[model samples]
Target: MSQGVEFNRLMLEMRSMQADAMVRQKPVASTPEPGAPSFSEMLGQAVGKVNETQQASSQLSTAFEMGTSGVDLTDVMIASQKASVSFQAMTQVRNKLVQAYQDIMQMPV
Candidate 1:
């Protein structure tokens, strides 16, 4: 078969494997009571991920600036781009959450 066809087949196989793994994964059900920290916990986790991504980007930038021998420019660029995308996504989520909160607050009691 052609190289493109082989690559497509490989990608299909990888996706199938990923789907199977996801299907077999156990679900974690939360039993938090009302007024608990479900929202805070999710927000904290998202913020933590964003912070980690930002730190990775900062390190990559520093390595690039310091002319580190082991750091490739392409890798640094990719890391920075990934961090930027994640930051943008987080900002969008925050905006939507704020809008939802405002809408709920405006509803008649």
Candidate 2:
């Protein structure tokens, strides 16, 4: 469904970002590209998005539990699942980042 499509799109974006990072050469100067956001900015934005998703999901669940009109159970469930999936994806990314850092730190000088 739409969720599957969205997830696929997210995965594609991640792959493209990873490839781009790998393909990039070291810059002569410390300054980043004029228009491109820094890695920290991108990471912050992603975290913000996940936080937003979880907050929205929580609000939806609360509305449903309070018997608010026009709040469907299916919609609430879908939001919950989306939030859960996003959180899992973030966790996996964090784990990979940590592992990579450890591997780099353990490298021979």
Candidate 3:
């Protein structure tokens, strides 16, 4: 079905984005180039992206529920799934960050 194909495409897109993020990451000891975003800035941008995705999904669902023309059920479902996956990914990253922080704090001074 076309829905399955679309879902596959979305998953591929997410994987590519993850790869790009990995490529962008820098080592802790390196000095960032001028104008490059710092680690905190990058993290903030990622969170912003997740927020935007969720908002877009909400708007799409609302439009579909309101009987707006050109709103497809499949599209709404896909958007909702994308939002859910992105939120879960963000939550995992947050958990990892918290764990790292706790580990660092427990280090011998």
For lDDT, the strongest prediction is 3
RMSD of each: 8.5, 3.0, 2.3
| Position 107, candidate 3: lDDT | 100
Off by over 4 Å in 1: 1-37
Model 3 has an lDDT value of 0.86
Point out the worst 10-residue segment of candidate 2 by lDDT: 23-32
Residue by residue across 13-105, what tens digits does model 1's lDDT show?
546744755654444684545654455675687678778978998998998899989998777776776667668867987899899999999
Clashing pairs in 1: none
What C-alpha lDDT does candidate 2 achieve relative to the native structure? Answer: 0.83
lDDT of 3 by residue, 24-43 (tens): 77888988778777778878
Q: Write the per-residue lDDT of candidate 2 for residues 1-109, one digit (tens) a residue.
A: 7667766876786688678766653576766667776677777877888899899999999999999999999888878888898789889988999999999999999
Q: What order do candidates take by TM-score, descending?
A: 3, 2, 1
Whichever of 1 and 2 has more lDDT, that candidate is: 2
**Candidate No. with top TM-score:** 3
